[model samples]
Target: MGSERNEHPYGSLKDGDKISDKHKRELGRVRSSPTFRLGTLFTKSVEKPWRLLWLPFSILLLLVQVVKERVGATPRYSNSEPFTGESEQRNCVVFFPTNGVGLGHFTRLLSIARRMNKADPDMEVVFFTTSPTLHLLREEGFAAYHLPGRKEFSNMEASTWNSITEEMLSNVFAIHRPKAFLFDGSYPYRGMLNAIVRRDDILRIWVRRGTFKKNAPNVPIDSFDIFDYLIHPGDSVEPNIDEDETNNSIIHCDPVVLLDDEDIVASDVLKSRLGIPEDEIVAYIQLGAGNINDISSDISIILGVLHDAGVWAVMGESLLGSRIEISELPNVRILRDYPNSRYFSSFDFGVISGGYNSFHEAIMFSLPCICIPNSKTGMDDQFARAKVAEDAGFMLVEENVTRPRMKNLVSKIIDPENRQSMVESGNSLRKPNGASQIADHIARLIFRD
Candidate 1:
């Protein structure tokens, strides 16, 4: 079977077909005629009587149906408080950061949580991530809970997993009683998004990023219409917020990393904490957590390049004890923490992946960077990210990162003119602390503005 011959939207014009000027003129004349204009308006005018007659009846029926459903369903408000203004009510904004492939999702949510708490100190911000990194949140004066990853439950029976997840979401809703739920992931779990709607009166906001790498895994991202607000914490250097691609109701924010200057340790403090020497030109290396997408293959080469250039490399705990000879070299030491963005002051330069949290923090802290995008992961999307920066000439980016490429890029970052160009470019972008701006958006929704 094939497409029908008359399938063209305008007409049956096929390849190599041309419309005569007379035909085009006739079509244009009819479209521009007062008769055709009046015909369209007349159609609308004729429908007005039916619409006026039935609209109120339809609204009344909807109201009655709502009353009927509420009679036996869960109460809208358990406190039995009468209808009041938005100011009187303290609302909670629940956040779901998906699972822990890397710390990007987790740290971005944590950043938003901090801003939300500060913006409306009275309102509550809750987190439900599958990562056990809630200890980081507790240290930051926020409350959070963990949900088991889908992979854990996916292995078992579907019926069993559904029942358990449904129950878990129900309990979360009952405990939190959120005014809104914000999700940050490519594929938000259906059970979780549906749970918010089931609870009723909860706005669902999605913090989705985009323009993935060619090889990025395809996560099931369907039913986007269910969300009330689709917030894109957009990249600083990438034109990632394309209207043609994303759905309506997208709220775009700039550089939504966990950037609280108060959390940034002084240069001496960070060095002392990491036990890096004062004489060493320490280079921070974080190619993501390496839990899902391992980029440790080039770790030895990268560290060797930096080491040969008289720079001690700092890494996360993932590569520290992995017995990689290069990472375990005398000049390399691990940062031993999640949300290592706070320790930006510790390093003179950085070799970072294009993960949202890592790259933006490097830009935010003005660290001259050589970005090696980790292209092998479940929606890590580092290759596309690095491509954007490289194309824009903002940062030194590498996709197929070889030892020679690493050497060249590292040397480029070391040059004063080139390093200053990258630093100035990053500085010229929208400033950090988009977390506060996002919090303001949430507050506006809560206040019914």
Candidate 2:
């Protein structure tokens, strides 16, 4: 947490140091026009003259004002400082989750927030997200602010969308004045960095799970300097990538899961609710949320195997993408559920992709699953995560996925002894969910007397 402000673009300027041309332009442009409402600096400035000589004097005056504001923003909290209990009255923490191609980011943050609130009932948690699953948040009784991603707007340039993000997110901060800010995503957006600049009042945190491939692009080093803490949720296999000193306090915890074992419904009750026969064996299938119509898709192959093997199937459909449609297949049901781990008890085994959330959930729940890792995901090394489980004899990984191979794996998984062995192994290796540990840490930081 004792990071140098020099690493940031807006870091303190010295007597001999030169101001970057970009910040000067930003100050001028934001002052001259009312549209650029990024930080709290809203003072009006004179229009630029036709003569270039006036530029130096104008920049000098603006720099003086910015320096005064920065001084006010940099007030350090001393140990002897009296606790006013101001934040307790507000008692809010803001969570920002990027709308990735999947719901991994949103769900992980949700898991943490839920634990935080449960541990401290007085804490009010709010979400500021680009995720389309605001309805899901509301159902969980948390207020969420939504901003559509750049892809959602037709013909809008990325810069313009970022400007909108900065303006809207800044407004949210003004309204809530949250005690802390937590973001879970691979890359921190420019707008996010701009809006959160010099907010020394709020404890800023970033949650980044690792398992990236070698070719993955690195996040900006300067971006890492902006946060007070970096929390890395652990993976089954520690990623092969090297970790650098990002100058922020880093905390490593066990894998985060949304639901505990007690949260799972009883198998008989869950089956009855789904209109499934109590005597039937069920397999839960959740590949990715890609195009389902492709006949050669993995889901199709798995479905064919299940049908032939006479096993009932419950397919997990995601809430983010388009609805999955298929002609009626007997004894096959489609469950469009959020945090599908709640239903893990009803299924005998799972055929799931090795995304962070699903793979971790399967292991935590002791659900014997055959993991088929998705190779195309940007940062998550799904294969590496699955290989760790496979090597530990807790699960199986089928990389090539053929009908014969899948059928054989499915048959092997459903055997009573094999399933029991996998379950026992996973139970031995299981760790307490990281969400509670993170939640308690946050409470200590914000509520310490």
Candidate 3:
């Protein structure tokens, strides 16, 4: 009997004193308790509409906290003082080369101002430039303040910081007390920043174009502590010497290029003025802006090649009087104060003494150039630039121009195969519309509220 009872599957109940239905019912009730029901309800609540609303609210709260922390974390440097919100409406003046020495600097400055105006029309951009170049800027509908006197290379050395600073500051303060002042070129007038810094209300920026050449003698570093920023558009070309570092400085802005509708239109007009035939190939020859030393032999060599290829030559102001003998060449034309954009575009090729302005302009216009560097004027840099361009398959005249070399290079560029290759290379290397990128950087730095 014991063995049979053990074998039975329901053997655990034994004789359960009383097999009561009430005990079984109580066990079933225990499994359905309120605690388990409440747990299920809590999980369903997480998927309800109220949870969705709270989730977005929590995210918004997190974003607000992050932004507030970021704003607080920004560096509270002394340089930031001049760019405060209270000075937003104040005038911003830019002083650039106005004379016809090289329109490159002025054109680049103008392009920046135009971009600034487009970004914020309320901001004022005043130019304190030379008289001769004033007409060029005015023609483009820019409001500029023309400084008295002409640009004289003979007096360039004598135009010292002490003398020019007073004049520059006087002009700037007289018309409008600018909140920000910008200057172009390597040497900005000395004490100009000191005068601006005295006010404590102005920000001054220097737009430097040239890079220090390797192995060259060290140039004296100018003290620009009074200025808030020293913007190097092509700063990456070389590491700046420690002596050149400014105290209140912001570095690294894109290099400026002047490319606008007005510039294009003016260039087209210049092409017609220079008698450049629309269909024939044109070559622009510039022997440094207004610094031509000897041109008769140079022009003769250029004319010989142009005559052979039927290409027109557009010469700049420097070659004006030098072209007296070469004027007899039917294909040669002299353009004084011609718009650079038109002059650059009028040419399929350029024969230029290597200068930053002309080099960048040729690259900007995607024109092939035969660069003949003027070694006599400490322009050894042109040789390096020419070599780089030549390595990239663009035309280059070996340094120190000789009649035979000029003629040979000109002939090579005129050849359809060679010219086509140069054009393609230029198109590949061109960095167009850099001005807008520069402007955007400046606005962010100076006007970021």
**Which candidate should be chosen as best, given lDDT against the real structure?**
2
Better of 1 and 2 by lDDT: 2
RMSD of each: 18.5, 10.2, 28.9
Candidate 2 Cα misplacement greater than 4 A, ranges: 1-89, 239-242, 291-296
- Residue-level lDDT of model 3, residues 1-449, one tens digit each, is 00011121211222231123224323433433344434434555576857555665555654564454334332111221221212122435455543333455576677788777677665666787653556656665666765543244346543363456444554454345454677765444433433354345555676655554555443223345555776665421443446345465656554456665345554456667666667788778776754435655775777777777788787765422333444777888776654454556566788886666677667766778888766544312556555666777775767655767777787788887888888888665565466777677677766554
Candidate 3 or 2, higher TM-score: 2
| Residue-wise C-alpha lDDT for candidate 2, range 94-177, written one tens digit per residue | 999998868888988999999887776666689999998998899889999899988888999977988888767766665666
Residue pairs clashing in model 3 are 267-342
Better of 1 and 2 by TM-score: 2
Residues 144-211 of candidate 1 have per-residue lDDT tens digits of 77766756664776445544554566456555556678888877564564345433367778877765
TM-score of 3: 0.68
Model 1, runs deviating above 4 Å: 1-90, 214-222, 236-248, 318-328, 391-393
Cα-based TM-score, every candidate? 0.73, 0.80, 0.68
Clashes of 2: 0
| TM value for model 2 | 0.80
Per-model CA lDDT versus the true structure: 0.64, 0.75, 0.57
